[model samples]
Target: MNILVSDFDGTLTEHDFFELVRRRWPLPPEQDPWNQYWAGEITHFEALARIFAGIRSRPGELEAMAEATGLDPNVGKAVQNLKDGGWEVVIASAGCGWYIERLLKNAGVAVKVHTNPGSIGSQGELLMTLPYKDKFFSDTTGVNKLAVVQDAMERAERVAFVGDGRPDLEPALLVPPQLRFAHGWLAQELEARGESFQPFQHWSEIAEILTRC
Candidate 1:
């Protein structure tokens, strides 16, 4: 069987959910952990932890806000189609598990999800945990997509990855050219690297491609 693993934030959804959270419940302007991560001064997990620490809202409120985020219109149907065709679909993301779950549930899509845990602590501080820390390769994003993809590769006859950002780059490289699907920024990265990949704008396109796999 073929396993299809995808990044949830920008690939499945119309917008980046993390960015949405930061925008809706922002930290102090002086605190710039994201820039630190971008500048290679901190790991992604450290950056996320710092950001979460600055959150004043409860988990439920954040989840509610996440539910308000939009997804690609065709994603739900495309996932169902892939499942109906006997392909296993999985969401491997660095985003919060609770947030990812809420968004998927709101969209009426059910699939296996692997992500970091996020919630509000008793002291009203934002709580986050890296469940897959032991499996981390290098960059500490908590949940490593490359590790997840590598494990999936061992079990499936074929493995395909769909993503749209920097986090997806290493995992995308692990998959063969035909099975790597890129969109948005990921496509640009692949083109710049001169790596082979299929470009897709919608999940329906991915579904169509997988049908013939």
Candidate 2:
């Protein structure tokens, strides 16, 4: 069971899917505090709480947001290669599932997706967001991304992860040395740190590495 655990927004897709949601359901100027929040001015818990609160405040925003983001064409072929190689592929993302599902469907890849579910109310309000992400996958089944990769290693001899952002950095710290991390951010903060990562601007780099693996 060769395993590949990846992130959705920046890792697999060229766009930040969450931004699609905002575009569909434009927020009030007062609620436009996300930039300050994500820039480390506010804690993650606070940022998320405000983000959800804002979503709930605006009705029918989630569905419109989900429909706005597009998919990357290269993902389907890469996923097929992984599956053809007998690898268990999973998406470990903090983002919502609506966008991820649509993107994968467009990619024509039949694979397992692990992420938080997003629901839109009849009136177009975002009802709830589940915190399905975990810091590591060592203790559980392949639910938490790190745990999923750890679990996959039990069946496969090799494992690799691809992602971008600080959240993905958590997995980079915990994964085995044999496992590789492919960074997707154009300007990654971790690059300055001692963490080892293979920077990539596009999926072609990932395709090249997966072929070697």
* Top-TM-score candidate index: 1
lDDT tens string, model 2, 63-92? 445544445567677767767766667787
After superposition, candidate 1 runs with Cα above 4 Å error: 25-30, 58-61, 122-125, 132-139
Q: Give the alpha-carbon lDDT of every model.
A: 0.80, 0.60
TM-score of every candidate = 0.87, 0.73
| lDDT, candidate 2, at 80 | 73
User: What global local distance difference test value does model 1 have?
Assistant: 0.80
Q: Give the per-residue lDDT of model 1 (tens digit) for 1-213.
A: 889999988788777766765886676645678877888888887887777776677547766666566677777788888988878998888777767887778778899888888877775556777774445434477678898899999999999999998889999999999999998889999999899999887766888789777
Cα misplacement distance, residue 54 of candidate 1 (Å)? 1.8
Mark the regions of model 2 whose C-alpha exceeds 4 Å error after superposition. 23-68, 131-143, 176-179, 184-187
Q: How much is the lDDT of residue 160 in candidate 1?
A: 94
